[model samples]
Target: MIPLVDLQTQYKSIQPAIDAAALRVLASGEYLGGPDVSAFEQGFAEYCNVGHAIAVNSGSSALHLSLLGAKVGPGDEVITSPFGFVATTAAICATGARPVFVDIDPLTFNLDPAGLADAITPKTKAIMPVHLYGLMADMDPIMSIARQANIAVIEDACQAHGALYKGKRAGSIGLSGSFSFNPGKNLSAVGRGGMVVTNDDEQAQFLRRLRDWGQDGRYNHVHQGFGYCMDTMQAAILNVKLRHLEHWTELRRAHARRLTCQLKNSAVTTPPEPHCCRHVYQVYAVRSASRDLLRAAIATRGVDSGVHYPRPVHLQQAYAGLGYMEGDFPEAERAAAEMLSLPISPELTDSQIDYIAAAVWSDAWRPRAATANLGVKSTRDLARPAQEQSEQAA
Candidate 1:
């Protein structure tokens, strides 16, 4: 069976150097904030074209620490899209800020810059725009709106490791950005890890102290902060993977293009690129009215499939206090019901993608234009969170 992301193949291809890096870290006396982590931070910052990079335990930590560093706190409101991984909004809420959600642009499946400006208000403190499915958000307009409103823009670049926007890096375009190196991510580490990058020294210092339990040094606590430091082992693994990130990203893009061509007969709605942005295709999701049936059909062929998010955050039960109704964010609700992700990993073979496409074609699935305004209720509307929804429904 073709996997969603074959990390084993990636590890095998680069085992020599990866093994060496791991051995070096293991032999070294320092395990956490050592040379390996420092090198990775510098390399990642340079890759993003940013001034500083602070590694953390997870992507959620990266977002939380970045928000706290930017001074987003209780009573503040963060404007973000409802059409992303739930972690994006949850990180904002973890800081005690209310998350105000906007709908995504159907074409890019990213936060619509138009809706971003409209969501701004006196209570708004920052904008958390997710680079969904490895595509950068429309950063120019988002930055413009943020600058005028005096709101910080923090990018959720978890899926977009090397994506670019108008010659600038995806995570580098905003005031600050965060990335994940979960084994499932395009930039997989040996284990869970993430980074926050910024050009501002003050913000960088704040994150440093925050990730280390408010300590300027190791033990002396200065202010209240979270212990969210990334480990050295993951850093070593990331350093090895970073060298081949660009090549892997391009391979994912190539596989996505192959699938697009094979499935372009309108049986499903394949994504289209924005004018100047390139999608790295971390997940090649297609919209089908009968996505579940098609997914089952593909599974019969032993092909793996997934739904990046079957539910939007606004519809989540934990945030139901936000008072959003079913039709509140039409685009996001529509995406919840229609989108299904197939295999588009860098390690996937062309024949595997062809087989997946052939399976879809045989299933007789067709695009449903009526999905444009199909406002499904929040998955959490019944006072149950998505995790519970999944558990109970299953």
Candidate 2:
């Protein structure tokens, strides 16, 4: 079957460099926060065009540190998108701050800047906008609003390593940004890792302290903190991968363009890449009236597909006490039911992309009337009547 992401292919392509890096780290005997970690932090900071980058153990840790570094705490509020990974909101809650959610723009699948003003009140301390699916959120208006409200903007750029908005990188536009180096990400590490990037020197220093047990020096603990330090092994692996990131990102973009061209006229709605923004296509997601049925059909054809999220963050049972009910955010809820991601990793070949596109087209063109409400009744239920008629004739 065509896999959703082919990490083996990527690994094979860089096996020699990866092995050398690992062996060097093993020989060094310094496993935690070493020269490798410091070098990677500097390289990544330069890549993001920021003044500093603090390496951390995980993206969730990066977010938590950023909030604390910005002084966001109890009795404060942070605004974010409802249509995102729960980590975005969970990080806010971890900071002892309330997560105030807003709907998304149907086209970009990012936070709607128009709703920011209404969500802001005296308690609003920060706005955390997630760059979902490797597309940068509408930052121009978001920055304008945040500036007027005097609130910090923390960009959740976990999925967007090289994405650009109006020529600026995703992590550089906000006060501080968070990133993930999970194995499947564009610039991935062999194991878990994350980073926080910012131009503010004070915030950068605070993040450094927060990640290292609040240490101002080797044995001095200046403030309360957590153990969020990055592993030297992961940092070494990521630094090698970072050199090839731009080349891999271009390959992903090329695959997305080809799929879009091939599936343009089909019933599936191909994702959009606006003119002013550069989308890295981390996930090539499409929308359909019968998303679940189509996904099953594609899988049966030896193609793999997935749902980025089957439920919005606000609708999750974990956040029931947040007072959000069904239909509170219609656009996000609608997207949850309709979105499905296809294989668009840099490792996929041209023929593989074509095969996946054909599978999607074959399943997408089934009569709209038959597939429209399949959520309430399945495809098997719709076909049962015809089987009964044939049996009766016999």
Q: What's the lDDT of the predicted structure labeled candidate 2? A: 0.87
RMSD of each: 8.2, 9.4
Please give each candidate's TM-score.
0.91, 0.93
Tens-digit lDDT string for candidate 2 (107-167): 6778888788999999999999999999989888899999999999999999999999889
Name the runs in model 2 displaced over 4 angstroms: 363-394
Best by lDDT: 2
Compared with the true structure, what per-residue lDDT tens digits does model 1 show for residues 1-394?
Answer: 8787788898999999999988888888678888888999999999999999999999989989889988999999999999888888889889999999988886677888877767899999999999999888888888999999998999999988888887788788777999998988989887889999999998899889989999988688987988798999999889889999899887887787778777766467775555366678888888876777778877887888899688888888877888888889987887888888988888888788888888877834443452342343321112335564344223
Clashes in model 2: which pairs? none
The CA lDDT of each predicted structure is 0.83, 0.87
Model 1 residue 78 lDDT score: 94
Lowest lDDT 10-mer window, candidate 2? 373-382
Cα RMSD of predicted structure 1: 8.2
